[model samples]
Target: MDGVNAATTDPLARIAELPGVDEAVAEARTVVDRLLGHRVLRRRSADVSLESALRGAHASAVLDGAEAPLEQVRSGEADDPRVKGALRVSGELGQLVETWPKAPRQALARLHTLAAADGAGADRLGRPRSAAEQAEDPAGLGAPPAPIEVEVRLEALGALLERRSSAPAPVVSAVVHGELMALRPFGWGDGVVARAAERLVLIERGLDPKSLAAPELGHLQRREEYTAGLRAYLTGTPEGVRTWVLHCCAAIADGARDSLATCEALKRG
Candidate 1:
């Protein structure tokens, strides 16, 4: 992921300074510093990574409408296909984030493969859905863009990511997640995959370099609001976009605190 951080020109510089976003970005930086400043977490890196993966998978699965107990999901006793797919993608995030910034298409394909392989069928993994195969977004926002639209938008998104905008990583990441969710390009499992991609931005951008935060958990904790935030992003208005960005910042800050909780849990155990 080091390649993803080449300190390029900040493509998102202007957007970061927009109305409500500056405040959100500032608070996000504070939350990030607070998380990274934890001495106990530095000493327990492995446990932090493990808990992040576990909680992230659990929370993402719930957002996809497959709520399951943490222990059951952890033990592989959760028989739901959605949960199973989210688990696979979340577990593989460490390897995936490394590829995301440098070769976004390749990275995104790999993510779709993992999230869709079990549930969507082995044959369909790693590709967009056919017009015949495209379905309603799991988030129930609307019917997906046509296959051609998906292709065009996806190409644009890949370019945006590869350019590695200097926008605050969290802000860039929120846009990435939003675009993915909006495009719903894949044949299956985009919600979980989108969150994983967002996490990759945070990881590679050094906002949460230890990979110990599960912002997905924050979304799950505020499911209705989270869904509304995404809906607002779909509106494409400036205010709507700012609402989404601020919502994402709050989730990320909550995720930082989630890491603190993981630190407490690991300390106790």
Candidate 2:
């Protein structure tokens, strides 16, 4: 609701105001603005977006331990449940974008349902992990928060999602991404849902409303850096959290580069 540089009580604003964030935000916006200005994107936004979603699905899947060559993903040859789950969430994100600010909990539940229905059991889909259900996770999310803690965090997160934050879209998106991953608010497919949520913020906040960027592709290309950023955020240090925010901004810029490449490929083909 407020400008990126606006002062607000929202904790996310502090992370956004960090030293490197302004430059990262500027570069990411500049790159995406250039991509959006391209004649090809102007005329064929839908087609290019479809292709971007395909790559984004692949990248999201890769982050969730479902690595596959882009060609394989394009051909529907990558059939792991994790990849399928990631694709499901990616496809559904556009539908949820408009409603996310109004009803984050419902939107998040739908995301969980889409991502974890196949592997997390139908009964567990769209719900938080139960006390009895909390066990060693198969998805390698590491130690998960307790059910009580998850519930508390969800309430806070829900409140935070009610409207736009003073933070820049990229910064807000990164916090959404990091918080979900760290909280693992749902029992399964937290990573998939986290990423889906980040994309929603980008669109809803007007950072990339056409949703042409392949952000997950950026994460896929630099998984090590991405993981380090999340780890830094988890450290609870201002410097660490700021590093993560900056990393996300950089990733979005890289995603814009991929969007430009996609435009060129589509025009050539």
Candidate 3:
């Protein structure tokens, strides 16, 4: 895969051609489609969506180092600002879905603002970090790209989102997620925002329109692989990019399985 600043006419289309991406994407689609067909979703999809959102937020917060149990998150006892921010971003995702493809940079700023509401000052909320500012390294991936590099990559990403492409939704979603993870554009809450953005892409692109699958849960379940995948993406090699995309596809399938379990539990009751 080319760099984020690549001049290709369709970056995601190129990504779709990466080895194993198509197979992984097909598997993820099969899982998600099966999840969409689960009996409980017909009558109790609202319940499932709510549960999925809560679980997704909780998992994303855990990735941010909040680490509360799901029940704690559900009962409103998890008061970590990261937890609160992840919940806020989850709630805001539906509203941002439509905005994402049209104006990705603006949508990202909105997500960062929601995710960093408590952690960042008023002056810093939604603002990309300046060259002098340092981002917190939650993934232990080391220092982020310099500010100018961040700007260029983000601009390129924004353009990619706004343009029409023939790539599969999973491919596009993986790219969006990987690029944001690598960029860490903001000083705070970039991880939450990036995960939220991935969900939004999956929703907007129709991979998981109701947002039932909790990919964050899948990522959390495979925490070591999650970190390793992102680190591989940061390496900018074809093999590394392939590994990251396959990891995301597997996460989507795992998340769908988790949602299916939610439906099953609801059915048994």
Candidate 4:
């Protein structure tokens, strides 16, 4: 969080103007709105939110190669360290939501602290990788940025997050997600931290305040597309960025639909 500032230019606003971005965002919003309006939420949002956390953690674990079933996760039978760490991170989101806007770095560190707790040494849990370290390339996205570059970009991103953005929440969240995935700042659990950060943005920015939607599940379902979109984003072209943003929005919509199904099931029984 080195270069944080109260800057005037909204980088995310510019990203929102990219072709088809608005449409995709609008659709995601609509689906989320539908999920929000469900009668189940009015009475049992707490229940839905709890269920969502389980599903989200399970999906995130699967993406990290843990591959636990939802029931296994809920029953506390998924003993993989990655799955357990993901569950830890999911359980902590409510507390971190308030901290995210004020101190994103702290929030991120806490996320990593939880997500990589069992895998990383205690000293390395929240620390970004140094030049001597090699980040895990789970997605096989070539080499991660150098330690210096990761630091600079993270500082700039922190600066951006400290202020209000004219861009939609979807755009901001997508950028945060893509950038972290691309940066791989920490040596372990960077992907889990990145996606959790995106969830915080979507929560803080009013898109899905209760965290009912499991966008991680959407990403899990569309694994190939998610990877391709992230790869496109890493290319640093307008087309690539737009592709990633659209893909993220689609995943969000899919998450909303999944939540809506959850609502239906809860309503029936």
Candidate 5:
């Protein structure tokens, strides 16, 4: 949302030069093919809920660990509120994935407003105090901190989406993730909002997010590795960020491939 200035440099080409990136991409492509097939089968099934279908496909093959069964989620028997919340968020996210792109910033702002009203979780969109308030001398700190940075960021995101021909998927992804994480603009459910925003971006680009898979699920799967990668990325090293991005891309491809395979099997049956 900042501006083109806030837009980070695309690292795909640089990442491509890294060792094993190509191989990773190839493996990812294969996995995506299979996931796509499974999605087809689920689509063919009249009784399958879209949320359940994606959760199952993502959990088993694309995610790092064993997925919770679809029946278990639908049964609403989980004692843990977090698990229930996760499932509910996942379903809402799936629905958003099916919808086309909306104004990212405005949507986020509205979500924050709703979150604040309902005491959902976090209130990220609160106003910032003027610099005068920060300093003893009124004008020394310069103009007051505007309350509209969030709106500005949202507008910037919309602009980015409008003129995205030059940006690669990973770069777009990075920007989106960085903004949501940095802003934390909602009163609650920041994590879910961030993930939902990512899915929305993918869907807007005509990418099948349902097939692309959830990186959080993957992060959860390989917890140590995932945390290490995130730490590396955050520590001014690009290696971990590159690793995480490629891992996500690979998961997307793998999930799609698995979905495709399931669809084929269902068809044969």
Candidate 6:
């Protein structure tokens, strides 16, 4: 089928040209090992459905600031309702990862549905937008940007995902992040969608999404530097985007390691 031809000159290719992708992948592998090891330690009968609910709830909390400091969602704020929401989201995401091989399209659709629901104020976090207001917008959190010319970008992303031969995670993530951030489809949920979308990709790749070590969280951690990285991408050249991808890759590698450690500890206990 004639589709958007993903150019080797795309940002994913540019990321490969960077100095340390091999090292990043190697590090990512260690994190993956820990994740698998942790999973092995879980009770064989562990309720997959229940886990999914927990993960989804946690994801919601993080996106909604029902839980602040994404890292605290599991520990410090365990009792917080937002944390519970984030947990449910995360768990749901994990199950989706395990069961669904082709999840990107589904994930995107789900995110859009969530944003639309919110925009219509049907959700606790959503606000209302009139048909005219929704039609004229360019970028927001609850609905697609007005005029919606950017659906092409999403098409390009799906094409990239389909054509990837190997090393799909970083490539998929770089393209998805670039497009979503650029599109900013929903008024308030852009960041959440971007982050959640990355998590979805990682899970589909047979990696642990929770182990993502969340570059966005890291970005939040180093707000000034992270914002500068984002600004460089948004205002500078493609180099800025390349730099952000590298940073994100590094964050994922780091988060995987942390999750592995936590999983291992839990297993031992």
For residues 91-150, could you state the per-residue lDDT of candidate 5 as single tens digits? 544444423244455555443343233323342332222322221111121222233664
In order of appearance, the predictions have TM-scores of 0.92, 0.93, 0.96, 0.95, 0.59, 0.66
Q: What does candidate 3's lDDT look like per residue over 1-269, in tens digits? A: 45344426676777787888989999999999999999999899999999999999999999988878889989999889999999999998999888888898889999999999999888999989998788988889998999999999999989888996778888788888999989999978999999999899999999899999999989999999999999999899988988999999999999999999999999999
Best by lDDT: 3
Instruction: State in Å the error of residue 41, model 5.
Output: 3.0
Off by over 4 Å in 6: 1-11, 38-88, 94-106, 114-120, 123-146, 165-167, 209-216
74-179 per-residue lDDT for model 4 (tens digits) = 9999888889998899899989988999999889999999999998888888888889887987777889999999999999999889977878999999999999
Best-to-worst TM-score order: 3, 4, 2, 1, 6, 5
Candidate order by lDDT, decreasing, is: 3, 4, 2, 1, 6, 5
Sum up the clashes in candidate 6.
35
Clashing residue pairs in candidate 2 (N, C-alpha, C atoms within 3 angstroms) = none
Off by over 4 Å in 3: 1-8
lDDT of 2: 0.83
lDDT of 2 by residue, 216-249 (tens): 8888788888888888888879898898888888
Which residue pairs clash within candidate 3? none
lDDT of candidate 6 over 1-269, digit per residue (tens): 11123334354654555566556655765765655555633663143323333443454444445435545543555665435434434545554564333545566555544544433344423222223443222222233434345555656666666665354476566556656665664444555556667667766765554433444444444445544555555644666766666666666665555545545555566
Choose 2 or 5, whichever is better by TM-score. Answer: 2
Off by over 4 Å in 2: 1-8, 134-141
Q: Candidate 4: minimum summed lDDT over ten consecutive residues — where? A: 1-10
- What are the lDDT scores of the predictions, listed in order? 0.81, 0.83, 0.91, 0.90, 0.45, 0.51
RMSD values, in order shown: 4.0, 2.5, 3.1, 3.8, 9.1, 6.2
